[model samples]
Target: HMSFVAHSGTSAVGTKVDVHRSPTACNIPVVARRNHQSCSIVPALRYCIRNERSPKAPSARPAQDVTTSLAENLRALGADPQVILDHPDLRAADAELLTSSLSALSDWVPRRSLGALLERHPPLLTAPLGAWADFLASFGFQRLAIQELFLNSPDVITSSSVYRAGQVFLFLRQLGLRNEEIVGPIFRWRALLVEEADYQSAASFLASEGGVPDELLPRVASTYPGLLAAPVEGELRPRLQFLKGLGPEASRLLRGFLWEDWCGWIHGLANWSTAVAPKLVALEDLLPGGRPAAEALLREVPEALKCPPESRLVPNLRLLTGRMGIQGESLFVLLCGAPAILSLPPEQLESRWVFLLEAANGSKADLLAYPPYLLASLSKVTGPRFFYITLRGLTSRFMNRAFNGGDAVASESGRRGREVGAGFGIAGSNEYNLDLRWLCEGSDDEWLKRMALEQRAGPGGGGWSAAPLALVVGMAGEARTASHGQEGAKELAGQQQPQWQEAGLVKEELLLLRGDYDEVLSEWDSLLGWCCDKAFTERGCKRFEEQLSLFYLLIQGRM
Candidate 1:
C-alpha cells in the first residue's frame, strides 16, 4: 500500500511549486480534492531537441506517424483521445516539429514535468521552445533549474521572446558578476526578461532620479534586480521622492527593509503623486490639533502615509478616540510609536484592543503607558504568545518589541503619558509607572532583572487572564457569566493549570474550555508516520470553525 508522486499545477501566476497527492486521497473515503499547488519540490517541465534546422510550416492534419503517437501518448497520460483531436492547431500540427520542440525542452525539463506542462499549456508543443535552452544554459541554468524557471514563467519559452530576454541579460551582465552567479536571482526576479522592463531606462533612473552614482549602478542592480522591472514613474519616483521629503534616515528605509517588504512598501497606484499627496494633506484636517500637528506627525512617522489615511488609518484612530478616550497628544504618541496601526483593519484593531483589555487583563492605562506593546503582531505574536504563557506559565518568555526606542525615548514616552494622563485627570504613576521602552527593549535576562524592581513598585495593572473567548470575539457580559457557577473553572483560570487536574473535569466543561485549540492541534497531527501539515488557509479555517461549533452550542446549553 502506499506510494508517492509529484503533481503539476495548472497556472503560472501564483503556483510557484508543484504539489503531490496523499494516501487519504486514495485509500480513505473520498472527501474533497485540494486545488492550491505550492509544494516545496515538485517536478515541473521536460523537453529535448535534435539538430537545428530551418523552422518549417505545419502540414495540415496529423500524418500517420504523428497520428499514432498522439493517440498512444494521450492515452498513456490518462487523458481523453478527443482532447488532441478537438484542438485546431494540435490536429494540424506536424510530428517532426512537435518532436523537435519537446526534444529541446527535454534538455532542460524531464519527461513527467514536460507532460504535466504540456497538459496545462498545449501551445508549448507547437511554439519555439527549441531556441531557448541553449541561450538560457549559456547563462548557466542547468537542466533542473531551467525546468523550474519555465514553470515559474512558461510564456518566456514562446516565439520571438528570446531577443528581449537576451537583451536584458546582456545589459545586466555589465554588473561584473558572472552569469552563473546571477542566474538564480535572474530567475527569481526575471524583470530583465519582462517585455515592458527597460533595463537601460531603469539603469538611467538609478543614475539620475535615484541618486545612484554611475560607479555604483551595477551594485544597485545586483542588489535589487527587480528594480529593473519596477514601474519607474508610478512606484519608483513617488517612493524615492517621498523618502527624500521625510529627511535622511527615513529615506534609507527602502534599503533597510527586506527586498520583498521594500517592494510591497513602495507599491502604489499609478499616478501615485497625484493620488497620494492630497490624501495625506487632507488627513491633517481630520486628525486632532488640525493641520499643524498632522504635518508634524507626518514628519516624525512618514510611513503613516503608506496607506490611504482616510480608508483605515483615520477610521482606526477615531475608533480608539471615540471608544476609549485616546486623543490629542496621547493619540499623537500612540501613532508615533506604532504607525503600523494605520495599516491594521479597524475590526482587527478592535479585537486586539479587546484581547489586551479582557484576555490579557490589561487596561486603558497600559495602552497609554506602553504604546510599544501594540507594535508587534497580534495573531502571530500577541495572541499565540499570550496563550503560550497562560498554558506554560512562562511569563518571563513574553517579550515586547515596539518601534522607535532609546533610553531617551523611554523617558519621553513616560513623561508624555504622565502629562497626557494629568491632562485627562487620571492617576498616572500607579498604572503608568513602568517605562515602555525600558520594559520591552532589554534582553530577556535584563527583563528578568527588572522583576524585583517592578514588584517593589507595586501593581501596575499589567497582568492578563484567560478571560473567556467572548472577550476576544463577543460581548463582555458573555465573558462575565461563562466562568462562574461552573466547577473547576476557577482552577484553570490560573497559570499552567496542572494536567492531572484535567481527569476530574466533565467532558462538556473541557470542550468549552479548550475546543478551538484542540481543533487546530488535531488538524495538524501526523498520520501513519508522515507529518501532514494543513495550511492555515480558508478551508482549513472552515474545518476549525465546524469542529468548534458543538462547543459553542454546549456553551449556550443547547445540549
Candidate 2:
C-alpha cells in the first residue's frame, strides 16, 4: 500500500545525493516521471573516437575498457586525471588548457570548493582566465580580497557574460557606492550586477519623486536592493502616487516602503486600491476628527493598505454600527483614537463587539472615548479574565462626551475632560480605567498584569449581568417591528428593558443567538482537520510535528 523512493541530484559540494519520498497508499495521486536519457560525456567521447578509428569495422569492447582508454589519453596531455574525473565536463574539454586554467585559478579558489565553482560555472573553463583576473585587478581588489570575493561569490570570476557584468559594476558606481563599498552589496546579491533598464528607471523615479539626491541614491539602493528590480511604470510609480495622495506626512512615509518584487507589489497595490481604498475613504466621515483626522489616519497606519477592505474593514464597522448600535460621530471618535481596530479580522471584531454590547452592556459613548476595547481578543483575554470589571452595572467614568460639532468642539471637550479627571481619564487609578493606547499596544504579560491589578482594586462602577442573552430575543422582535416606519426603533427600544437577572438564560443559548453554531462549527472542523492531515502525512517527518501542534492549538480555539 505504500513505498519510499529516492531522487538523485548534484549537491552544493558537487556530490550526488538521493532525496527520499514518503510512503503512501496506491489510491494517492502519483506524479508521472518523464522519459528522457541523461547525457554522458564519457560514452559520447568513446563513440566518436571508435567511429573515427574504423568507420565500417565493428569494434566490441566493454564500457570499462573504453573509459580506461579515455583516461590514458587525458593523462598524456599533462592534466590531472582526478580533476578531470571530478569535473566530468573536462573529459571533452581542451585537456591541455584545463590544466593551465586550474593552475591559474589555484591561488584564488580553494582546492575543496574549486570543483564546486567549476560545477556551478563550467563556462569558466572555456572563457579566458587572463581576462577575468585582469577584470578583478582593474576593480582595485587586492589579491587576498579577490580570493575572498571569489570564494564568497564565485560568479564574479566565472561569469560567462563579462560585458553584462561590467555594465552592472558601472551602474552601482553611478548609484554612489564607490570602490570597496560596492564589494559588500555586490557579493551579497549578485543579481544587482546584472545590467537591466528597469534598475535605471527605478533609481530615476526615486530621485524625482522621493527627492533623493543623485549622490544619495546608493544609500537607498544599498538599504533596499530590491528597488533595483522594480518595474518603473507598473509598480514604482503607482505606489508612490498612492502614498503621495495621503498628504505630506504620508508622502514622507513612502521612503520606508522597502523594495520588494515589482510584480507582487503591483498585484497587492491594485488589490488594495480597487478593494480596500474605497472603504478607507468611506470611513473618513466615521472618524470624529473629520477630514484632517482622516488624513492623519493614513499617515499613522500605512499597513491598512494590505487588509482586505470588504472582508476585514467592512465587517468590523458593521459589528460596531449595525450590531452594537454605535452610530454617527461616536464611531468616528472611537476609530480615530485607535486605527488598529480596523486591522483585526471581521470575525474577531464581531466577537469583541458581542462581549462589549451584550455581556458588558457598554454604552456607545464609552466606546468613543476608549476604542482599544475593539482590538481586544474576546475569547482569549476579554471573555475569560477581564469580563467581571466591565459588566453591566459598572459606570464608565472614563467615557468622555466630547463630540459636540466636529474637530474644534471634540478638542475642547477632551481638554476639559482631562482637566476634570486631573490627568486620570483613561489610565487613571479607577479599577475599570485603561488607556486604550497602552492596553491595545502592550504585550500579553503587561495586559495580564494590568487586568490582575484591576481585579484586586475591587468592582468600580457596577455589578455583573448576563444581558448578552437578550440579543437573540431583541433581534427577532426588531425584525418583525421593522414593518413600521419611524416607530420601529421606538418599539425595539421599549422591548430592551430586560436585564441579566430579569431574563433567565443559559450560556449555550447566548452563543447560538446570532448564527447557526452547528453548521459553522462543523465546516470549520472539517476544513482544519483535512488541511492538517494532508500536511502531516505528506511530509512524513518528525520535524513537521510542530506544525501539527499548531493546528491542534487553532482547532482548540475554534471549538
Candidate 3:
C-alpha cells in the first residue's frame, strides 16, 4: 500500500494512492488501512517509500487546520495574520484583532468646532488681535464679539503695529462698524471724552447704553451734517474745537478720520467748493497752526490740482494761495512749472491763472519771444556775468524773426539756395558761421608757422603741438600714398571708382573745413582710395593727390 500522511502525524489510513505495474497495467488504491496490498501496489509502495525516504512529499490536513497553517505562514512572512482573518472575503476572527491593534496605536482625537470654542472663551474674540485673531477671523465671528473686544481692549487695538492696525481697520470696515460704533469703543477706553458739562452725564448714559457720547455725537453729526437737519453750528463747533485742542498726536489721529470723511464728502459733491466750502474752511480752522500742519495741507494741493477744470482749479488755487501764504509755493510752482499746463488752450490758461510774462533785465523782446524757454534758461543761470551774456546771445537768436523764418524755409528752397541755405542754416543753428577754405588752409598755415617757431625756439617753447601735428601728417601721408598706388592699380585693371569713396571724400572736406582734423583724417583715407582709382579723371585725381601731399608736408613741418 502507498500512503500520504498529514504533517500532524494523523491518518495514513484515509490516504488515496496510485500504483503503476508495467506499461499497460495501472492500479489505484483507496486505502483504509496500512496492511492490505497487491502486486502493482508493491512497486508503488516501493516508489512511495523511496519518495517518503527522500526529501519531498505532499502532506494533508483538515480545511480548518489548513487555514490556520496558512495564517501562521503569512505571519512568518512578515504579513499581518489578522489582515487575512479580517479580510471581507475571510469571515475569520483573526483580522479583527489586527485592526483593533492598529486603531489603538493611531490615537485619533475629535476637535471642538470654532463656534463652540468662541462660545466658551468669549473674551478671546477681537479684531486686530494678532495671529490668533487672524485665525478666528477666518471663521466669521459675529460683529458683536468684535465690538465687545474692541471696546474692552483699546490698548490691544491701538498698540498694534501698522500692519496689524491696517488689518483691524479693514476687518472693522467689513463688519459695517460705523464711526459712531468706533467712537463708542474709543470713548469707553478713555481715548476720547466730552468737553461739555451736561454732555458728560449724557456721555455716561450713552456709554452705559453702548452709544457714542452726546458731545461726540454732535461733532460727528456736524462733520457729516447732511445726515441730520439744518447745521447745528454753535453747538457742534465748540466740540469740534475741543477735539482740535487735543495735542498734536490726538490732532493727527483726528485729522486722519476728518480728512478721510471730508474727502469722501468732497468726492460726492458735484462741485466740491460750492457744496463743501464751509466744511473745508472748518477743516482749515481745525488744523494745527504750524509749519508741519501747513506742509500737510500743502501736500494735498497737487492731487487737488490734478485734472481739475479751470473753473475748479482757479478757485482752489486762490483759496490755497491765500491761506498758505508764502509756503504755498507748491501750487504756484505746479501751475507755472508743469509742461502740461503750458500746453493748455489760451482760454483755459487765461481762465485758470494770471499770466505774467516778465522779462529778465527789462527786455520786452525777450519776454515776447520764447518766454517759457527763456525762463527755463534763466533758471539755470547761476552766479556769473558770463551766463547772462550767454542768455542774452541765446535770447537774441530766438528773438530774430528773420533767422527763424529762414530756418523754416531753407529746406523748401531751390538747389543753389538749398546748398547756400544748408551751409548758412547749419552755421546759424550752431551760432557760428564757418569758412571752409579758410579753415583748411589757415589752420595748416598757422600750425606750420607755430612748428617753425617752436623748432627755432627749442623744446622749452612747448613741444605739445609736435605730437598732434606728427599724428595728422603721418595719417595724411598714409592716405596720399595709399591713394596714388590704388588709383594706378584700378586704372590698370579697368575698374570704376567706388561711390562710397567719393562720399567719404566729400565728408572729409566738410569735416576738414569744420576744423575736425581727427574726423578729416578718418575720411581722407577713403578719399585717397577713390582718387587712386584709375577710372577717375587724372587731372581731378592729381589735384586731390597734390593737395594731400602738400597738406601732409605742412603737418609734418609742424611736428
Candidate 4:
C-alpha cells in the first residue's frame, strides 16, 4: 500500500482528494459528489493532475512514471534520484537534457551529490551547463574552484551572463581584492554578478558621494553587501546628508570609519539626531561654549552619538560641573579632554572623582590634564595605588572647603592657604599632581621606582636618606607579588638596586632633561617650515647643548 496527497483543481465541482494505491493493481473507481466535494480513488491514478484528474469524484489509481528516465539517469550518476521524482514542482524537468548534462559533468565534477545539488537549485539543471563551465574556466578557476563556487552558491550556475561576472570581478580586483578575497563576497552576494550595473553604480556612489576611497571599497562592499542594492536617492543619499549635517568633525570621523558599512551607524545616527542633538543644542545655554562646543565634544567621542542626552550625557555634564566643581571654560576643557566621561554612569564617574579628589589630592585642573584618569578602573590601578600611597604617609588629608561647601568657599580657602604658604615644595606640598601624573603615565617598573623615590624623601623636601629605602623596596615588592604572583615579584625586585647601593642622580636628572627636551622639540616642530627664517644664533647653541646632554646620558647607561 502507498499513501499520497492529491490536491487537484481540475474538478468543475471544486473539491479535495485523498488518494491511496496498491502496488500491484490499477483500480480506477470514482465516488462522485455535488459542489466542493472530496473523495479518494483506489490504485489506478496514484497522483492527481490539475487538468486531468476529477477531484470532485477524486479517486486514486496506479501512479504514473512522471520522470522515470530522469530518475534512472540520476541513479546511474550516483546521486539521489528520488528527490527529483518525489517533488511535485520539479515534475516537468526535461529528463534527456538534465541527464545529458549530468553525464557530461562526470569527468570534471563529482557525480555523487549532483542530483541533490540540482534538487536544491533546480534552475542549475535547466540553465546552460556549458556556459557556466566555460565561464568558470575562463577565469582560471580549476575543477576544485568550480566545485567550491557551485557548492557555495548554486544560483551562480544559472547566472549565465559571463560578461556581468567578469565586470564585477575586475571591479573588485581593481579595488584591492585578490582572486581569493573575491570568492567569499561573490558567493555571499551572487547578485553582484546577476545585477552588475546596480553594484557598479553603488560602488561609484560610495566613492563620489559617500567619500569612501578606492582602497576601502572592497572592505566596504564585503562589510555591507546590502549597500550594493540600497537606493542612492532614498537610503544612501539621505543617510550621507544626515551624517554631514552633524558637523565637519562628525562628518570627517564618519567618513574615516565608513559608518555606512557599520550595521549600527543608522541606529546611532537616529539616537544622535533625536536625543543627543537636541540636548547639545540645548547645552548652548546651560554649558559654556554652547552648540559649537557640544559639536566639538561629539567629534572627540563619536560613541556619544549612541547615548541618550537627558539620561546619560546631561547627567555626566552636571556631575562634572556641579559635583566636581568644574565650570566655564574648564567644563569645555574637561569635555574636550575626556568626552568619554559623558557615557560613564553617574555612580561610576562620581566614585572615580571622589577617589581622585580624596586619595590623589587631585584638583579639577588635574582631571582636565589627564582625562584618561576618569576611565581607569578603580580596583585595578586607582584604588590599589591610593591605599598604598595613603598607608605609606605619602599623602595627607585636608578638609577641602571648596568641595565641602562649593567652588566659592573652596576658592576662599585656597586663597588663605596660598597666602600662608602652608604646603610648599615636594615633600611638604600636599598637591601631588606631578606625582599622580607620573604614577598614572609611567609603566610598571617606572611606577615602582617613582613610589620608592617619594617614600625615601619623607615629609621634607631635602630629607634624602630619611626614610628606610629597604622598607620602600619591600613594599613595592609586596605590591608586585600580590598583584602578579612570585614570578613577577622576583623579576621586578631584581631590577632595583640594593638598599646599601650608592645613589644615582644622573639617570633622574637625565629623565627630567629629556622631558624638557621633548617640550622644546614640540615647540620647534609646531612651526613647520617657518622655523627656517628665524635667527640661528642661540638656537644652534641650545640644540648643540641638548644633543651633548643626551649623549652624556647614553654614555652613563653604557657605563
Candidate 5:
C-alpha cells in the first residue's frame, strides 16, 4: 500500500500543482487528494501535433514521481483514471513509447476536450498513438484534424496499427485517388483507416477473382471504405461468394449500394443470405413480377434496393396502387422505368403525383407512363416548367400523344384542333405528343430556351414560326378579357415596342416572324423568368399571360 503524491509546490516540478491528502485515490493505483480536491492532472498544456511542433523534450518517464502522476494527468483531462490504471496494456506499455504518445496526444487537443474523449475510451492510452499520429500527418492532416480523428474513433486506436493504416492508404492511392479524396472517406468512417484486415488484398481479389472492373476500383475504395475492413478469407470472400451464387447482377447491385445509399448498413450485414435475401423475398412478394422482376429491376438500376423493400418499396407501391390507381403490371413497369423513385420520401412522391395530376388535367396515366416524373424536383424543376407552360394555356402541347404500341405517337388533340384563327398561329398540321422529360432534363435557363425553341417551331406545324409567342400574348389578353370584360381588351391598345435588351429577353427579331408579339418582347421576356420567381407568382392574381398582358398595358411607354 505504498501510495504517494508528487511533492506539489511552486518549486517542486514541471507544473506547480498544489498538494494535500485524501482517500479518493483511484481504486487500483491509489490517487492522492490535494487540498481536499482529488488530484487531477495538469489541465492546460501546449496543444500540438507530434512532430508538428514539440515542447522542450523531457525523459519519457513522466515528470511526476509515481506512475499515478500520469493517471492523475489523464484523469484531470477527463479520462477515467481507474480504467487506465487497471488496463493490462498500461502495465506492459514501454515507458519510452507511452510517454512519447501521451506528449503527442497532449498537443493534439485542448485540455478539456482531450479529457472528455479519453473518458469515453480509456484504452486509447494503451495503444502506441505516436506512430498513429505520424501516419495521419503523412496524409497532410493538421493538429485540429488529428485531434478530431482520435476523438471520433477510439476503437480504431485501441486495436489499430500504423502498418495497417498504411496498407489501407496505399490501396486507395493505387486506385488513383488523391490524398484529399482518401482523407474524406477515412475521416467519415474512421475504422476504415486502422482495421488490420488486408483491405488491399480484398480489393485485388475483388478486381481479379470476383470480376469487379478495374476502372471502378477507385470509386469502390473511396466510397465504400468500410468494405476495406471486411476480412479477405472469412468475411469478405465468403459473403462475396454467396452474393455471386445469387447471380452476378445480384452481387453488383448490393455491392453498389455499399457506396451509395444505406451504405453503412449494408456493409454491416452478416451475409447476403441472412440480411439481404430476406429483403429480396419481401420485394418479390410486394412486386407483381415476383423475384425475377425484382432482380431485373435492381439489375437495370442498382439503386432501387438501397432501402429495404418493406420500408421504401412497399410504401411507394402503395402510393401508386392506392393513391394513383396503378394496378397489376403497371406498378412493376413504373418501378423498372425509374427504379430510384422507390427511395424518394412518401411526401415527395405524393407531391409529384399531385402536381402531375394537375398538369395532365386530372390524369394519372402519365404516372405509370413515366416514373421518372416521380423522381423530379417538384418544387424546382417540374413545378416551374409545368406551371410555365400550363399557366399560359400551352400545356396542350404535352397533354395527349397516343401510344404507338409502347412508344409515343403524336396526335392532334394537343392543338385542341382549334385553328390558329386570327391571334394564335399554326393553323393546321398535327404533332402534339410532347414528352414531359424534356422539361426537367436541363438547367433552368436551358429549360427556358427549350420552351422558346419549341414555341418558335410551330405547335402543330412542326417548323419554325413565331406564332406561339403571339399566341401567348393573345392568350394573356384572353384571360384578362374573360376576367375583366371589354376593359381587358382596352389595355392592349396602349402597348408600345419593348426594348428587348432591357427586358433580358435575348433573341434576334427574326425569330418572331410576322406576329402580334413582334411589338412587345419585354412582356414575355420577363414572363418566363417571372414564372420561376416565387415572389412574382405569389403577387399576381391571374395566370402569367394575364399578368403579362396587364404588365404590357401598365408599362406602355417604359420599355
Candidate 6:
C-alpha cells in the first residue's frame, strides 16, 4: 500500500488515507492496493524513491572530458581546437581544454593574450563596442570586457561614451593605448567646432595643436568678420585680434591666398577709414606734394607696370598724370599726339589750347619732322596753326637737304619772292599757275588731279564746310584788317576768280585744287574713322568727319 499526507504550514499538519482496489483473477498475480492520504505523504515517498536511484544514472564525465571531446570533434573537422574555443561562444572549461589540446597538437600554438591579438589585428581595436562587448560577456569577463573594448576600440569609444564605458568594463584597462590614438577620435568629435560661427572651439583646437588644418585658414578668414563682431571673449577673439594686428599687408596676403570671393571682403572695407586713414597718411608722407615725389613715383611706376604686364598705356597715363600735379600746359604738351585728350573739352583749360595749321606756303615734311616738344613749346606763344606752318617750313628745309641735296630755306625764300611778285598782278597775273606748280612739284600729277576732282564733289556730297570757310575768311579778314581793313580783305578773297581768269591759269589752278582737296578729304575720312573707333566712341560725332564735312563745304562755296 502507498500512503499520502498533506501539510499546510509550519504549525499546521494533517493526514488522511484512502485505499484503491486491485484487480485479481484466478491464476493472475495479486495487485497491491494504493492508499490515498495527505499530499505530504506522497512527496515523502517520492523523495525516498529518488534517493533510492534505481540505476545510478551514469556518473557525469569530468568537465575536462567534455572539453576534450569537443576539441577532438573540432580537430576531426580540420579546425584548430584553440581557434574554435577562442571564438567567444564556447564554454570557459571547454576553451581551456581546447587550448591545451592545440598546444599539444603543435609547438607553434598562438598565444591567446589580448595584447598579441590586438598587435596581430589592429582593426580589432577599431571594431564596434557592442560586438566585442557581447563577446567578453560570453566569456564571463564583463568588467574586463568593457575596459578592453574602450581602450582598444577608440572609434567606438569616441562615437559613444556609454559604449566606451561598457567597453572599459569588458576589456579591464586598455593595455597600451597612445594619447594620440585616444585624442584622435575626440579631436574629430570637436571638428564640428571649426564650422561654428563663434570659431572659439576651432581656434582653441589650433592653439592647442600649434597649427590647424591648412584647409581651415580660409574658413577662418571668411568667418572672422562676423566672429570679431561677436562679443564672446574666447580663443577666436585672440586669434582674430592677432590677425587684425597684422594690418593691411597681411590682409592683402590673406586675400591673395583665399582668392574666392575675397573682393566682397575688400569692398566691405571701402568705408573703413579708421583702418585705412593711417595708411593714407603714411602714403602722403612718403609721396609729399612736389616734383621729387612725383619723380620717385614715376621711377617706381615702370616696375609696377612690368609686374602686372597687362595694364594699358592709357590708364597708366591717367594715373601718372593724376599722381603728378596737373599743370595744364605740361599735360597738353605730353598729350600732343594723343587726339583723345581733345574730346575732354572741360578738362581742357584755357591754358591748354591746340591749334591746327594750314601750312599754306611751307613744306609738309618739315612740319611733320620737327620735334613734337619744340612744336608744343612754340604753340604756347604763337598761334597754333602759325606754329604748325613754321614747323612745316623747318620740315621742308630738312627734306630739301635730304632729297634735293640743297638748302630748302633758300628755296622757300625764292618761292616767297615769286609769290610776292605774282601777287602784285605784274607777273602776268598767273599767281594760281605759280602756286599750283610750286605745290605739285614732287607729287604725282595723276593722283593730285584725282584728289582735286573728289574734293570738288564734296565729302559724301554733303556741303558741311561752309561754316569753316566763313570762319577762315573772317580770320583772314581780321588779319588783313589791320593793313587794308575788312573791305580790302573782302576784295582780295572776292577777286580770286577774276585774277585766275586774267592770268589764264583758271583751269590749271582748279585742277590742282581739286586734286589737293580730294586727297585731303579722303585722308581726313580715313583718320576720322580710325580715331572715332579707337579713342572717342563716347563722343557724339566723329571730330575728323565733322571737320572734313566743313572743309568740303568751304571748298564748294569758294568754287
- The residue pairs that clash in candidate 5, if any, are 25-31, 26-31, 41-72, 41-73, 48-107, 77-115, 78-115
Q: Candidate 1, after superposition: displacement of residue 175 in Å?
A: 5.2
TM values, all candidates: 0.42, 0.36, 0.18, 0.35, 0.36, 0.17
What is the alpha-carbon lDDT for the whole of candidate 6?
A: 0.32
A best-first ranking of the candidates according to their lDDT comes to 5, 4, 1, 2, 6, 3
**Ten consecutive residues with minimal summed lDDT in candidate 3?**
377-386
Global Cα RMSD, each model:
22.7, 23.8, 37.6, 24.2, 19.8, 32.3
- Runs in model 6 lying further than 4 Å from the true structure: 1-515, 523-559
Evaluation by lDDT, superior candidate among 1 and 5: 5
In candidate 1, stretches whose alpha carbon ends up further than 4 angstroms from where it belongs are: 1-65, 74-92, 174-189, 251-255, 258-559
Choose 1 or 4, whichever is better by TM-score: 1
Model 4: CA > 4 A from native: 1-66, 72-80, 85-89, 104-108, 112-116, 135-145, 159-191, 210-374, 377-381, 388-559
lDDT of 6 by residue, 1-559 (tens): 4334534334255544222212122111111122233322222211110111123344377766767775675555455656545544343333333343333323222233433433333333222334333322322333533554444443443343322232222111122222222221122222221223343433344334323344443344233323322333554334333334444544444443321243323222322333333322332233323332222222222212112212333333443245334333233223222222322322121112212122123222232222121223222222222222132232232112232322333344334323422322111111110122222222233323323332443444233221211111113333454577666867775644332233233456666555544454454445342332222222323545564354344333221
lDDT of 4 by residue, 56-144 (tens): 34223222442566677777766677765555644676555565566555544567666567667655665445545554544444567
**Local distance difference test values of all predictions, in order:** 0.48, 0.46, 0.30, 0.50, 0.51, 0.32
Give the per-residue Cα lDDT of candidate 2 at 237: 76
Best by lDDT: 5
TM-score of 2: 0.36
Query: What lDDT tens digits, residue by residue, belong to model 2 across residues 1-559?
Result: 2122323233232212111222222111111221123232111111000110113333465655655664564455444556555665555664445545655666566666666665565545654454445454445445666666565655544543334444455567656775556543234335554444467777787777756667667766675566666677876676656555655443233332322333223222323446445665757656544444554555446656556677777777777677767655455445555567777766566645543543344445445545666766554444423322233112232221121112333353354334422342422111222223332434443333333333333445133222221222324443555656576768765765323213444334444421332343344344332332233232332544554455345433221
Which is superior by TM-score, 1 or 3? Answer: 1
Q: Taking the tens digit of each residue's C-alpha lDDT, what string does model 3 give over 448-550?
A: 3322333333444332222222222213434444677976655533444332232233334433433433344344444333332221222343556564454
Give the per-residue Cα lDDT of candidate 2 at 310: 79
